[model samples]
Target: MRFSVNKSEKYTVLVPEEEKLDSLKAPQLKAEIVTMFQSGTENLIIDLSSVKYVDSSGLSSILVANRLSTEVNGKLVLAGLNEHVMKLIKISKLESVLELHPTVQEAIEAIFLHEIEKDIEGEED
Candidate 1:
């Protein structure tokens, strides 16, 4: 899949430039996410603004990302999902599990907020 990775202080934003996230590109995406996690990236935000379609394989890849992030006490968030993608996630009953935001900025903010909360809890501990 054609994509770009932007790294910031506490999170990484992956923007896929493909129109459809299908079996052909999902494996590559999943591999990349694994690599990022292994490299110490924890918080992840996937920007789906350019994606119009996502198949079951794509959803599986996303779930993999979420699992990887959670394994490290981080977060995986999705943003800018179009109607079709949103419908697919809802139909799959993943809406309650996956974090969704209307924009990348919102997702980033949420990530930072959660991080701060975690830090506060750690201090208490």
Candidate 2:
């Protein structure tokens, strides 16, 4: 539940200060994501560099974030995933479904690029 939320015009970055993202912290994470999305904050970057373990509940929370982003025409990016957490995501078959980045900077840049592409597409329309 302990996390930091950094919001800007482009995106919001959530850095959870927990080593294990399990059932105990999943609900809080989901709630925050939903709240942000409902408040019209779309693009999100979840930096999980500090998390060494994750469970099904954690994965469910992530899925919620992704779904909310999709519904809001936004993007939910996961960054700084360690080896074990990455394996968990892959095993859950979310490796292809979710946006994954090696670093927070890359994730932010990716979101920016996507927004640019969307803006271009909008202009064409």
Candidate 3:
């Protein structure tokens, strides 16, 4: 799946226009997410609204992005998951580890809010 990037609130959004996200495209997606992570961004968001299908490998790609974000004290978020895909995440129990927003705008807002909350906590110390 090919994607475009839009940086917002120190976050990079991977907007993929692919119809499916499966094993075949998982590696490429993983690499793209890693590239964003390595670009010194504070957060990342994979906008999956246009993605209609996801297999285990696709899920693995998301995990890879999550791990990369964590390693850098950044965030990896998801947005606009269809019900079918949402069910998959629920079944996999990945929802707890990953934050999901109803829309890309919300995802950006969430990342910004998360950063603010972190700053507030640090200041309170």
Model 3 scores a TM of 0.93
Where is model 2 more than 4 Å wrong at Cα? none
Question: What tens-digit string does per-residue lDDT give for candidate 2 at 1-125?
Answer: 79999999989999999999999999999898889998888899999999999999999999999999888888999999999999998888889999999999999998999899889999999
In order, the Cα lDDT scores of the candidates are 0.97, 0.93, 0.87
Q: Which ranges in model 1 have alpha carbons more than 4 Å from their true place?
A: none
Q: How close to the true structure is residue 1 of candidate 1, measured as C-alpha lDDT? A: 68
> Candidate 1, residues 94-113: lDDT per residue as tens digits?
99999999999999999999
User: To one decimal, what is the Cα RMSD in angstroms of model 3 from the true structure?
Assistant: 1.3
How would you encode candidate 3's per-residue C-alpha lDDT over 38-116 as one tens digit per residue? 7787688899999988999999999998899888878888999998889999999988999999998898888888799
Which prediction has the highest TM-score against the true structure? 1
Assess every candidate by TM-score. Answer: 0.98, 0.97, 0.93
Candidate 2 minimal-lDDT segment of 10 residues: 33-42
